[model samples]
Target: MSSSTATTAPPATTPTTITSPSPSSSSQQPKPKTKLKLKIRRAVAPADVAATTALINAAFRADDTTDVYLGAEHERISLATEESVLGSMTATDIAVFVGVVSKAAAVDYEGEELEHKEEEEEEIVGHFWLQKKSDTLAWLALLAVSVKGQGQGWGSQLVAHAEQVARDEWKAQRLEFDVVNTRSTLRRWYEKRGFVPTGRAKPFAYELHPDWEGVLRADLEFLYYGKDL
Candidate 1:
């Protein structure tokens, strides 16, 4: 999710992966299971700036799964930076959220081979950027999860949490955002999360700014979506 539209247009559902040993094997193996526990909180500026930037870039940069929207044609997740993240956090209209997982959960859900601080209590796994539009509406941007943290329902949880905050805390009547018109998979992901197309489209507003160095394709546009909070 992001603010690429000249200060306009802001910015997923998934299956649960919780598993347990088969009934037949439960008695013998103590019921081996894998669970994902995440802690989401408002991001602290300055301290979380760099980690947030790295996580966003790692999750959104041109890659096999994300190329349709962000690949070489769109540069990369280059728009995120310490300065920008910190700015968003400090701005009254914006709120930044970060998702974290404990070391034990990382080992059980992900693998030891993944990069993380096993010695630490928890590690950053994902983040999102939100901008309030009005008393009844808000925009979401920069939604992302670390590469190692994807496919385990983190995205879904992030979206649900965002809506709760928008509704309960901000009193937003609806939560809104946009997706690149060409990214069907991503669109479907949002659709599964209950966001529907508003039959709206607009020129893609982001260009390669000096801070986010990279090449961008021409004539891009976005499709908008909204959900009543």
Candidate 2:
């Protein structure tokens, strides 16, 4: 299959528990279900910035799952504190490139609202903030889902949407992203979606990449996943 097409699938078809249930619900026998939908957009307007930031930050906190991506936090959620939130916003625009469907869109959403949505109604529960590094290469900078919508397959859809964006908008030949080499759980998820390891890694500069940190260590080379579009 072409890499572009391959990228349009979930890193894993089936979902599994990546993190322990929240402490507030620890006493409950089973977790309550959360309704989730994820829709991707090529355009994120300046008006949508704050809400987008909120969603992105919430998603980032939830993404501390299984330490699979080797981000800023370990053994706990990083975005809960103020420092991490500031860090994430600094590294990225948090508004322009990636975000979940805004409440405004979902509340009043109809067939005509988004022409793309009318064609493909994969409601956005999460988003992967992408950046074009070059004409031939693109960066999967951030992948996040809303805190309330964690279990309803938003992660997979966002990943799929990233590839679609690559094909539809960027026309990328290969979609590339970095993940911690030690993060087998997340890596497995990406593998199921068709990403393969390139065995390349270097120290991630937290100062430059504020959303992420040195937790992965410079010694921990990220495995590069490339899908030929």
Index of the highest-TM-score prediction: 1
Question: lDDT per residue, candidate 1, 71-105, as tens digits?
Answer: 44454445455666666776667888999887556
All candidates: TM-score: 0.73, 0.57
Report lDDT (CA) for all predictions: 0.63, 0.49
Question: Which tens-of-lDDT digit does each residue in 22-104 have in candidate 2?
Answer: 22121222223433355466434433445544655555445444344444446323332233323333343221234355544
Give the clashing pairs for model 2. 3-228, 4-229, 37-123, 37-124, 37-125, 38-123, 38-124, 38-125, 39-124
RMSD of each: 9.2, 10.5
- To one decimal, what is the Cα RMSD in angstroms of model 2 from the true structure? 10.5
Off by over 4 Å in 2: 1-37, 63-125, 206-221
Clashes of each: 5, 9
TM-score of 1: 0.73
